[model samples]
Target: MLKIKNLYVSINKNLIIKGLNLKIKKGEIHIIMGPNGSGKSTLSYIIAGKPKYKIEDGEILFNNKIINNLKPDKISKLGIFLSFQNPVEIDGLSMYNFIKSFIKKKNNNNILKNIYKKCEKLNINKKYLSRYFNLGFSGGEKKKNEILQMLILKPKLTILDEIDSGLDIDSLKNILNNIKQYINKKKKKRSLLIITHYTNIINYIKPNFVHIIYDGKIIKSGNKKLIKKIEKYGYNKFIN
Candidate 1:
């Protein structure tokens, strides 16, 4: 569903991603792990078509079309959803208002019902529905809210950046299980790309592939066994 070939990216004339390559097929879940400054987040943003990052070389293809220069909104319209690492708070926009505006469905009642159902599954308080989006929400609550948006949109490719960071054990398990069920239900046309430093998520949703990204490039790629190697030896074993 997504392919990156020798992608070199830079911001403010400073190079970041260098010769990075990755491919994610439909129905597959890929995990990317790396230390700070490894360009993992940059790669995610690049795929989502975030502006200002110059694609110095190579290309990004989505569903057989080159998306290297498409705007973020256009990319999103092409069935890509990016769950931010730090979800921003909209000061005056109520969650209900935001959802109503963002979702393109014509049936308001059906949208509301689906939103409420997902909110209930994510343990989002009914009161939050009327409050400003993400305003004064705890880290976990914000994360859950991101998941809620994902559930409602049902994008073709979901890119979750560090979603497990602030989640507690129960929240993490619950959220991951929901994601697992979503992927299973739409396996033929859905795909997931997760950027995380934690391995606990593996217990809830097993990844089809694990990749170690370092210094702006994917250094190693393998199946679940790679997770064990990363757990035992750390990124040092994969570096250099």
Candidate 2:
């Protein structure tokens, strides 16, 4: 569903991603694990078309179409969903209206019911729906909010950046379980690209591929076994 060919990206001429190549096929789950300052989040931002970064060279292809210059709104409209690591809190906008704005089709009772059901599953209070988006929400609450948004949108390709970061054990299990159900609800492959540092995530979702990224490049690629190795030996073992 997504392909990056020798991607080189920079911010203010400071290189972040260098020669990074990755391809995530339809109906697959791919996880990227790396240390801090390793360009993991930078790669996710680049794919989602966050405007700050400059693509020095290479291409970002979504479903065979080059999307190197597509705007963030354009990318979202094309069925790409990115769940932010730190969800922004818009104090003036209610969560209900914020979500409504993203709905391309007409909003109706069915949509409202579906949203409420998702909130129930995420343990979100229905009253929060009327409050400002993410405002005064705890870290775990913010993460759950992101998951709720993903469920409502039902995008074709889901890119979750550090989704496991702030969540507690129980909350993490709840959210990941919901995400797995989302991925399996449709017969067609709804691709997933997860960027995380925690190995605990693999305990819930079995990824098709796991990659180790270091120094702005993916240094190794393997399966769940790689995660075990990282747990046993840590990231430095793969640095060479």
Candidate 3:
């Protein structure tokens, strides 16, 4: 559903993502792992069409259409949704208000009915509806909000950047359950590009393809077993 070739991105004139490449097939979940400062997050931003990360080279194609120069909302309009690694808390912006506006903007009338069902599955209460977006929310609450958005938007390609970080075990399981259900029970196939540093998240959400990204490029591509090796030996040999 998403393809990146010779991908390069920079911020403030400093190159961060360099010559990265990958392919995400329809209805597949892929994990991108790398050492610190390896440009993993930058690649996600580039694919999701964030302007702050200027692109110097490469091509990002969604559903076979080139999206290299599209604006963020334009890319989102083309069925791409990026869940931030650090979701910001916006005071005075109620969660219900944000979600209703987003659902209207996405024009996902079909998905409207399932919002409450999905929220209940994610353990989000109606009481939390009036709460501002992530304002004073626990780490797990913020992550649950991300999953809620994903469930509501139902984007074709969901790039989850470290959604597992800071989440407790139960909350992680809840988040993964929602994602798995959303991906599996879809009339329109949805794909995922999950960027995470630990394998703990993989147990909840199975990855069809796992890539080891290092030094601004992917050095290894394999199945779920590769993650086990990384958990045991780490990325020293892979990076070397």
Candidate 4:
């Protein structure tokens, strides 16, 4: 579903991700872990197609089409979703209108039922539908809101950036469980690219591939066993 080859990205001429290559075919979860400034978030933003971060070289192929030069909106239209590490609060935008507007723009004939189901799965109170989008929401509430978006959108590929950072245990469980539910019920591959530091998140979602990135490059790649090593020894052990 997603392939990023030899990606070299820079923001205002400062390089972030260098020589990064990764692939996500289908029915797979990939976790990207690295120390700060090691290009984890940079890779996420690069694949998300954010305009500011220029792709100096390489190509991002989504569903086999070159998307390196495409705008973020166009990327989303092609069924790619990025759940931000910190969801911004839009004071004037009601969640109801914001979600419905997005769905309408997708122009998919059938999405309403799944939308409400998503809200319910994320434990977002129906009343929250009337509230401003993320405005003054607690940290966990904000995380739940992101999951709510993920569930509703049901994009082909969901790139979650530190989604577990601010969420409490209960909220985290709900969000993770809902993701599994979405996969099982939909029977869609729905590739997940999770960028996180917490092994607890991985415990809930089994990743087919685990990649260790450091110093702006993929230092190592392995399977679920790598998660255990990280949990047992931490990134410090992997540095050497």
Candidate 5:
């Protein structure tokens, strides 16, 4: 569903992603694990078309079309969803209003019903929906809010960055369950690219491929077994 070829990216004149190549196919779940400052999050931002990051070279193709120059909203409308590591709070906007505006389709009774069901599954209280978007919410609540948006949007390609961070065990399990359900519901029509530092989420959601990235490039590609190895030895051995 998504492909990146020899991607070279930079921010504020400092190179972040260096000649990175990755391909994620439909129905596949790929996890990228790397230490902080390894360019893992940069890859996600680039794919999401964040304007701050300049693509010095290479191309990003989604659904067989080049999207290197597309705006963030355009990329999102093309069925790509990115869950941020830190969700921003907008004091003036309520969660309900934000989501209602985000969804391109009409907001009808059926959509409301489906959204409520997803909220229940994610354990989000109805009252929270009426509150300002991510305003005064705890870390866990912010992450769950991100998942709630994902459930509502139902994008074809899902990119999660550090989704497990700050989530308690129960909340983490709930989020993972929701993600698994989404993938299963879409069958082979959906794809996921998860970037994380720990293997805790991997325990619940099995990835078809696990890639180890270092210094803005993927240095090793393997399967679930790599998760165990990383947990046992950590990323130090994978560096260099």
Candidate 6:
């Protein structure tokens, strides 16, 4: 569903992603692992059409169409969803209000019912629905809220950047289950590009492919065996 080829990206004139190439087919779950400053997050932002990063070379294609120049909103409307690693808090916008505005045109009673069902599954408190979006939420709360949005939006390609970071064991399991259910609901029509540092989440998600990235390039790619290798020896051997 998403194809990135020879992608060189930079911010403030400093190159961050150099010759990165990745292909995520429809319904495939892919995980990207790398140490800090390896441009993992940069690649996600570029795919989501964040304007701050300039594409110096290569192309990003979504559904076989070039999306290198599309705006973030356009990219989102085209079925690409990115859950932020650090979700920002809006001071006065209630979570309910934010989601209502976000879903856009699907605010009927049935949709509301579905939203509440998702909230229950994600363990989001009913009271949080009235609070300002992400305002004063714990790290785990923010992560759960991201999953809540994912459930509501139902994007074709979900890019979760460290969704497991602050989650506890129970919350992690709940979120992972929700994700698996969602993917199964659509019969392998949804895809995910999960970027995480630890392998704990993978134990639950069971990604179809695991990639080790270093210096803005994928150094190795494998199946589940790669996850076990990274958990054992770390990324040192993958780095030059």
Q: What lDDT does each candidate get? A: 0.92, 0.92, 0.86, 0.85, 0.92, 0.90
Candidate 2 residue pairs in clash (backbone atoms < 3 Å): 27-189
Worst 10 residues of 1 by lDDT: 198-207
Q: Write the per-residue lDDT of candidate 1 for residues 168-201, one digit (tens) a residue.
A: 9999988898888899997889999999999767
Q: What is the TM-score of each candidate against the true structure?
A: 0.98, 0.97, 0.93, 0.93, 0.97, 0.97
Q: What are the per-residue Cα lDDT tens digits for candidate 5 across 75-136? A: 99899999999999999898888888876678567667777888899999989988999999
- Report the lDDT tens digits of candidate 3 across residue range 62-94: 999999999998999899999999899899998
Better candidate by TM-score, 1 or 6: 1
Error at 20, model 5, angstroms: 0.2
True-structure lDDT of candidate 3: 0.86
Better of 2 and 3 by TM-score: 2
How much lDDT does candidate 2 score?
0.92
Question: Tens digit of lDDT per residue, candidate 4, span 168-187?
Answer: 88888888888777766655
Better-scoring candidate (lDDT), 1 or 6: 1
The positional error of residue 51 in candidate 6, measured at the CA in angstroms, is 0.9
Residue 177 error, candidate 1, Å: 0.7
Candidate 6 lowest-lDDT run of ten: 103-112
Local error of candidate 1 at 117, Å? 1.0
**Model 1 ranges off by over 4 Å:** none
Error of 2 at 191 (Å): 0.8
The alpha-carbon deviation from the true structure for residue 77 of candidate 4, after best TM-score superposition, in angstroms, is 1.0
RMSD of 2: 1.0
Per-residue lDDT of 149-230 in model 6, one digit per residue for the tens?
9888889999999988888999989998999898878856899999998887777888889999898899899998898889
